[model samples]
Target chain A: MANVRIERLHKEFRGAGGIVHALADLTLDIADGEFISLVGPSGCGKTTALRIIAGLETPTSGRILFDGRDITRLEPRDRNIAMVFQSYALYPHMTVRQNLEYGLRKRGAPRDERARKVAAIAAMLRIEPMLDRRPLQLSGGQRQRVALGRALIRDPEVFLLDEPLSNLDAKLRVHMRAELAALHQKVRTTMVYVTHDQLEAMTLSDRIVVMNHGVMQQVGRPEEIYSRPANRFVAEFIGTPSMNMIEGQVRTEAGRPLFTGPGITVVLPRDAPQALPSSGRATLGIRPEHVSLVAPDAPGAIPARVTVSELAGPERFHFVAVEGGSIIVRTPAATVLHPGETVALGFDPDRLHLFDGTGEDAPALR
Target chain B: MPPRNAARLYPLVLLLLAFVAFPLYWMASTSLKPQTEVFRVPPTFVPETWTLRHYVELFWLTDFGLLFVNSLKVCLVSTGLALVVGSLGAYALARFRVRGKEAYGRLVLLAYMFPGALLVIPLLLLFRQLGLTNSHLGLSLAYLTFAVPFVMWVMRDFFASVPVDLEEAALIDGASRLGALWDVVLPQAVPGLIATGIFAFLFAWNEYLFALILISDESLRTLPPGMMRFVSTTDTNWGLIMAASTLATLPMALAFGLIQRYLVTGLGAGGVKG
Candidate 1:
């Protein structure tokens, strides 16, 4: 196992739109045997960062150190990295056994030894039945299993997965996520999985690196990131139902600070942080689950008109119109609220976040 | 689905098939007929009196067998060299980030489109300087001008269509760039190589202008130019020429029959090459 350290790596590609920055001064540290995920939307540079770690892409600047050794310019084969591509990338001409045995053969392992290793990995992946079948003969899930088996046979220090489960169907994707996590636990190798799905990052990785537009937004544990997002992007990007934001300003009212939006005003809690930005404009971020629905007469509750109500399994979501902006409020299935009905939105002061207008500005949880 | 409509289309389809097969039928029929019946008026579809005299003459009375062997040697050498060198060039075009790559690809194709007449004179001069005139090597080299480019263009497109992910996967699996190319990339290009190889071979086989200019010795003549010797200012032996043409087309059918299986089983399942 190896600890991977990336220091200020940058990657630029010249496209029709001129220079497109795929990775912008990115730095990350992955501890030995730890699972880390680079999570972002498309064009967010997360895949670029993963490819750079695998030595498949050259960084414009900075270095990648593995086990305290500089390997920035090393060839991918010399780096001892095994990667699973999003497409599985199985050799169609080879059978499942041959595909898995490819790396061992390249490393000059004996034929019998390679067969033993292939048999073991095939049994582990439950692809023993497919050993003699070409990749074209396998189903999508079977192909992914063979791809994983191919990487596992390498026994590399660091394993890189580039959205390996993204091509699977929804049910198989979830199943493979758990299988991959289990495989990581068994092997205890440093792994970096890249995905656009927030849930996959949250459930699979020990730490998640949230990125946007070639910039790192936050890097923390799943619950830590979910509860305390660093900026407005993270707050809105995470969670099942995205967090709601109200574009407003903070003003001092009667020697106390208050957040004022279109037609609503919220008095800031007295214990609000002193480093809260003094900017005139601030965004009030509220998580759907944190916004409790209450009677219209509740104190400190903003008046809202229920716009849409949706029931998904055991939970219910209510979209409420308040201050000329729509906000989603998640609640228990037992709660009944209909459109055109007026209700009060109870803000959880401990969970509420306030961000300055700019993306570079950090958020403060009040 | 309808019997009447099928019957109505039969005559048109048969007419088109006959239009296609008549030349082949005429060549065979004339090759089997005696010389006295070759130019008979009111052209008979079938030979009333058949004899193998022209075939006997094609094999024994002349050095045409040697000419046929020479054509095979030239075509096979040119095709083999084009596939090897052209595939390497195509792999470079598909994989590497060469400067002016688009312009280079376009220029390679432009070179292929040039007719043999345009390059044969220049080739003659170059061949004389290299002491390659009237040599099989010189003709094969001349054929490569277009053969290599045609094969390169076709192979480049096929290589590009193969996903680059396969090579990347191979590289990360402890294979070098060259190893990945040979192992993961080239195997997937079998179908394309077969297709392009036949075209390159045909280009050399049917090259009349260059063969006429490059080879003067009777033994070095290819089928196309060697058959031309039958139609002279004096008497034209249509029967022997037809027999020779019929004999020359068999090698192509043999070559196709040998490799048609790969064309059927090729493509899909492997990671895309590009």
Candidate 2:
């Protein structure tokens, strides 16, 4: 129902560890009805940004605009923002029906309106049977539903969810994830979800903001983040089995750019992004699925010995040891490769991600 | 527990029980005994003849009823004040981001550490200067110097144990901070309030030094000081004192009996999700 603009937010805490920067220079704009996810590792400031938007935490310096109005110093109750804490934070003394009606009652809604809203939310969440039960009397899944109901019943301008599905079991989390997506579709409220799970961000968010160590790494659509991460940290943190890194150097050889490393050499394409230093330290990153296994004697293949193989339902991950380091290759489950076997690892030229330097701040070549 | 372990525990439990229950039993039995049998050597474990004569005389012959009413009034007022002010102080100490919060909490307990005898003279002086001497209101306020600090010291931990996330959820759900405390936090701290209320009540009810020094009027005196009248210079009549003591303890016992269920729940049952 509202678009949010967070302008240059910064938050710091004077803790035992000195001045900790929980969030730094965070700025983003979420369109109305958009589902934006702030995804990163622990201590990455994703939750800090969400809390600041929810008015639960005050930013050390920044301005938060909701529908073009500054609400930076407003109390949470005045913000008309509903949040689902990761722990659910249900009122233990109240029954499920009361929990659903608490916000309405606080807003001075009439009795019939509160009853109608509670009944609608309970039915929407399929928790009608738990209307009279306390939070502790319900199971984990039931509590999660009630927490969601409590948030949804408020009908606030924006919804902030802090890893709301993190407490459920694997199956329940998946089910709830789909339900949350469906609910968002139904309500079409501007939602900002915070989580460290990349898969959830990829599957649910309209835009993903990747962050690390209190700084924004990148913000883009899921496919853009996956295929074109802005830096080495974002490249490695967004994928499972992590992207493989080959530390090497790039230089021009006979008018064709070339990458050379221990036990590996590849001739770069003529039109590859050419803003590199002619000859310098660079790292080549490629995802697990981008590498193919072939015979050792195949053309332009790097020879390696399989170190380990792990079965993962439909895919088999092969950990192979090259001369200077290792590479993980995700192959089909029926690949039938064994440890200590000699094979060739082939990189797809189109899928290769080249970074300019070896440090965490290294920018992608293109 | 296993039968053998439970069997071994019963005797020790009974011994402790008897050690505690014996004084209460003696007080009740002495209140029921005829004045003639009260001082018989080798005091009878049970009275030779049970009678309500002491209770009848204590109520009709003396100002015992007035003293009982004054004690109730003072204790109730002081306990109510302590609970209201102490809970707010404790909630702030537990939840707010005040600098030196640890020192502040310790200071509250430090206020309660001074002995009543040491404080009575200064309190009496202060009360007199403010035209508060010989009044039940003055005595109730004097009780707060000890009662409020004690309540805050204990109740702070109870308030702290209620998760802050619940309050945050309430805040985001259209409740103001004070409204959140009333709607979410206070409900979780009911057992703590009851426990602290009982302690504050007992502290004011049983206080004698300040009550004796501050109040000179017989009508304003509480039970603890009023009962001292039974001890004349020549002879100490134990029967009247015992009867008054037994009557004084009845309200406290009834209070505990009524809220004993809340005490068992302790703190929060499921305020948090996981």
Using TM-score as the measure, which candidate wins? Answer: 2
The whole-model C-alpha lDDT of candidate 2 against the native structure comes to 0.90
For model 2, how does the per-residue alpha-carbon lDDT over A200-280 read when each residue is reduced to its tens digit?
A: 999999999999989999999999999999989999988898999988998888888788888899777788778875558
Candidate 1 regions exceeding 4 Å error are A358-366, B1-15, B257-274
Return the interface RMSD of the candidates, in order shown, one decimal each: 0.6, 0.6
Fill in the DockQ of model 2.
Answer: 0.87
DockQ of candidate 1 relative to the true structure: 0.87
Segments of candidate 2 deviating more than 4 angstroms: A277-279, B1-6, B264-274
Tens digit per residue, CA lDDT, model 2, B35-118 = 889989989999989999889999899899999999999999999999999999999998999999999898898899978888
Worst 10 residues of 2 chain B by lDDT: B265-274
Residue A182 in model 1: lDDT: 92
Candidate 1 lDDT tens digits, B1-274: 6999999999999999999978988998999998888888987778999899999998888678888899999999999999999999999998898889999999999999988788989989989999888899889988999999988888887888888899999998889988998999888888888878887998899889999998888878888998888888989999999999888877886877887776454333212433
Per-chain TM-score of chain B, candidate 2?
A: 0.94
Local error of candidate 2 at B274, Å? 10
